[model samples]
Target chain A: MSTAKQPDPARRNERSRQAILDAARELVTEVGYAKVTIEAIAARAGVGKQTIYRWWRSRGAVIFDSFLALSEGAEGLALPDTGDIEADLKTVMRATVAEFADPGFEAPIRALNSEIINDPELAAQYREKLAGPVDEAKKARLRSAQRAGQLAADADLDLALELLYAPLYQRWLHRSGPLTPEYADALVELTLRAFRP
Target chain B: MSTAKQPDPARRNERSRQAILDAARELVTEVGYAKVTIEAIAARAGVGKQTIYRWWRSRGAVIFDSFLALSEGAEGLALPDTGDIEADLKTVMRATVAEFADPGFEAPIRALNSEIINDPELAAQYREKLAGPVDEAKKARLRSAQRAGQLAADADLDLALELLYAPLYQRWLHRSGPLTPEYADALVELTLRAFRP
Candidate 1:
């Protein structure tokens, strides 16, 4: 017979946490960040408000965590290095474009983004949790490209990364234009030319 | 005095409208967009709520108009053509950086931007009133540059415009970094290089 621990309290706690986060994300998509309440998240998750308060400080914090949860496993946000800088950046950006096109993902992310912009503390947490990792990954990829001599030795990786991603982000946030794979490809080509030795 | 025509009700109405818009901008900066109300704007401007309702349809519309009023005299958003695309873009971008750094401009603009992103109708209106003009101006400048042989003859002006301003907009909305003049200058140079013939 296989021996098993008695229900695994830690696993149960993690499941509860996941449930709460799932509920928060759903409520945020349905009702928006401003209308999302901890009480509502708790009720939706079949947990008590104390359970939520035990983990998060405010509704904003919960929403931020929920956003991170949603972004997890999103392949587009990941920086891939497949020995070709152009192809790698295009792959990642196309994934990002696809993510932005999904209403299920876009609504909650945009709502949380608004909250982050409004609240400095939450913004800091978001940058640390979400943006910081993506930025570091992209920078690492760019540094690798430099090492491979694909980019100018003196290229500003930070600025180059912004050029790669900022146009898509601007269009996404402002609804200036469609976020298409074609647009992503154009940005990749332009960025490569700009950074080429 | 010789041509005074019963105090010119049109001019009086224009003054009241300006007062209301000014009051809306000030209140948005002070109390934030969420807390700003028609009543508050009226009281601050010494006008009645009916006067505001007579012109604007909602608080969002009022805030939108208030933002336009605030931007009326700003030199940054204007696309200047000095026969040199690099110099002109750099000048405008540096001015934009300065404008964003001003708290009075930042708070109200940020507030209005959040509202625009949240409401599609408002976002459309914002695009028409604000983004439309700036985009047209930039495109005009880029087309002129194309004629002058500064840009590729077949360069995608729309995409090129995004490359010019999107980085600044991304940094502004995300608070990803300091909105410095140096950052603006770097973007200008990168874009010029990317679009070169």
Candidate 2:
């Protein structure tokens, strides 16, 4: 039958999506966020401009999707629940430090950050699509800690998460200080003290 | 005297510098960091491009100086030393919250952040010129607290400052949460707990 010669539309669509995201991440890192265009992304992905437009409204949307895919590819970012909040936090934080320090992630992440900083719409999308899920996971871990009496029963988890993570983020953003394993350990220890039961 | 018809060289230089900085800030707020041109700044300030070049190598440098001038104009950002660390911290942090929330600061500051995030040289300049002095003042306040036995005797002051401020910065940058006085007070309380003697 003629159907035997036809490609599966769903499979083709999935591959095209993956290809577009990959092209976006590569181009953003290579050329910086401001210079990367929809046409360029389409060319790099071996797709039509219309295809890219059909999927994403702008270059920022494509870049955001790339970051979302990158996170999902990195094991869904499930925080380790070892029942020891301090240990789990240190482990996860150290991994984060390592990722931020990696050359592969450095440029693309900075590009993502600059785009997010400049564009309020993209920033809002980032919060909803990317940060929301990751933060929810971290809060789930904190709730587990609270249940185990490691943290204050009524501690504001949002503030607790901010205190735990924002210093590392600031240091990286400003290049204010080094991101080391010891730094990761110290943040966890201090945050625990702050939220002690 | 012939000199009577001419402006003082030092005063002329100072006025030109102020004009350039003012123009840079206004243009960056109006057009954003990426689109602001040396030509536009020169035109707006009624100076030549060579003049901007004579002082700064690029637009980012000009913008950094603008922020530097802004901070200097804001009373050199001296942290209050009221001897009660918590009360003083609350006052300063609330002021910071207000500043970040100000519509006037919102655009230019966001422009500054994105520029700093993308340019390493500009970021280094920002550290040495802008953040350095303000941090020293905060550290001085923290040292006073340490002397009063309020914080740990050997507390890492740099880290302590980061703990107190970075969360607020992250919240503002990410639009992840509100910048409220109560939030500022909570940061002070938690940071103090973290470094309790």
Candidate 3:
């Protein structure tokens, strides 16, 4: 019995929590956020509605958390550091184009957009939970380039990040244009040229 | 009788058409899109609902047409061309910030966002009737700059336009940051540098 470890109930609870989030994400993808409910998520996860209620305040909270989790997994998945800002930005942008093109994430993202207009509460949650983190991370990367003398010293960090990122979002939500990888490469190149001192 | 002059029925009809559009815009701003109806617009316009139906396919049509008419008035306002592309872009962007800050347009923009989500048919109309013209105008202006050698020869025109424009839309729709002239100027400067060859 020497050096043996005790089993933890906390670990079991954590597994249940992840299962609930996975079920919510799956249901949201299938039925849309308008149709997703705590009861349905609970049933799918084999947990109780009370379990969901205990953890989150609204259906939006559950969905937003799921999205953040997915994004977190994909964070820095393809951002390049080839020492050439143009090539690196293009590499990252191309990868983002592919991610946004994925059918798995498209429905969930569109669902988020559909709710942002009518529901201020959901909109706030969406920005704080998902958009804010992604924006800040990208901004940090751009700022790092600036600090490394790869970009102009006085560059507007927020605008620089937005220039590189926002067009992809505009296309995805509005269907204004094809979000192809070629489109991404073009954005990266244009922005990289524009940013140089 | 030697110099018989005709009263222009076309002029009179144009005034009446504008009056109806004004009333409809006012009503939507006051009551919101969900509560606005054919009967209500007709009552406010002091005309028959048939008159509105004759011109528009639906209430969405009326609201959208009203916005388009307003934007046409706003269009000739012009992108400032001070010879320097950076300064000119900044001037135009600052004006845009001021325009969005105006409550007269802000309410309508919110209404438009909701319409885009709640009614797909209306969204399609908005894409054609509103976004298309404005977006194309901006793109054309950017392309003119590229031809004038203000930007790289290989710059992607669409992406260049988005790089200059998307941040403002992101900020306004999300309410995440200030819609100030200074912010617009910063964005212009940043984009100009990023796209510079």
Candidate 4:
């Protein structure tokens, strides 16, 4: 049970990590963030508690990893980089609409994000595991478009980045509105009109 | 303790409700949401628990009502409705930045919003009491601006609403970036540009 990220040794270790993540994800979905524990995850994964502690700090950290893995496997989830910035953004946003609609990824992520609001340590893990990569991907796309003169040269990339992605996250978290495919296209159009000058 | 809005004959009940709201807001700031109870609110306001609960559903509901009252009193806090859409939006958003910076409002609000994520009933109360009004205020401003020819006639008001407000909410909830006055100006400018044909 160490806080350090050690190098993986063999295929067996990879299998064990996968099994542990799977079990933890399932248990958290079945129970919840407050109720899921190392003992339950161990029993489900057929591993010792120390096995989980070997690579993660707490249940929050393990669940964060599980969400990251799930996001990785989701199809059409990447920010597209085709030369047409409008088309690429629409493609990515549409993909996100589908991803958020998926049961496997949405429920656990929402539950974890809900917890992060009150827990500082878990909130940090959430920003690192969830917002960090997505933020980077979006900034890269905006920068590339600006560089190619598709977007206004003076367009603030960070503002554009936040503008494009924030609505999706808001809808997903608040359950305030439908992130339908039509909504995705409309968002893209609005963003492009704003960014294109 | 039941959940129903009551009519006050002498307005004694109205005064009591305001007193309870004031006490709840003050105590929630000091003690946080989880510890702010019906009994404490009653004691602080010199009333009984049934007196407090005669009008609202739960502690979260009372806290939410208090938050709403605070926002509503600051008359300048509503979205500005000058014929110049950009300037009006910037005025409203700048005011929002000031509100976000106010510790008296921000601390208790942060605590209460965090707790609501885990409580669906509270979340519903929150949406109605807080989110719904702010959203309605924005829509009304947009409508007036559109009518004044400050915006395109056919702009999709619903999606436009998301574009203007969701980014600020997302940043506030996630602690992803600074919700500065500059960012607010940027949002208004970006949204205005998007509406251009």
Task: Output the number of the lDDT-best candidate.
Answer: 2
Interface RMSD of each: 1.1, 0.7, 2.5, 1.9
Error of 3 at B140 (Å): 4.6
- The sequence of per-residue lDDT tens digits that candidate 4 reaches over residues B1-197 is 35336654558877888899999989988987768888989999999999877898877778878877876743334576657889988888887777776777676768666656556666776677677776776778888888888788898777777788778876777766788899889888888888853
lDDT at position B177, candidate 4 = 76
Residue B106 lDDT (model 4): 73
How big a share of the true inter-chain contacts is recovered in candidate 2?
A: 0.91
Ranked by TM-score, the better of candidates 2 and 4 is: 2
TM-score of each: 0.89, 0.92, 0.73, 0.79
When sorted by lDDT, best at the front, the candidate numbers are 2, 1, 4, 3
TM-score of chain A of 2: 0.89
State which candidate, 2 or 4, has the greater DockQ.
Answer: 2
Clashes of 2: 0
Checking candidate 4 for backbone clashes, the offending pairs are none
Q: Candidates' lDDT values, in order?
A: 0.85, 0.89, 0.74, 0.78
Those runs of model 4 whose alpha carbons end farther than 4 Å from true positions after fitting are A1-20, A32-62, A72-78, B1-23, B34-62, B72-78, B115-121
Query: Rank by DockQ, descending?
Result: 2, 1, 4, 3
Give the local distance difference test score of model 3. 0.74
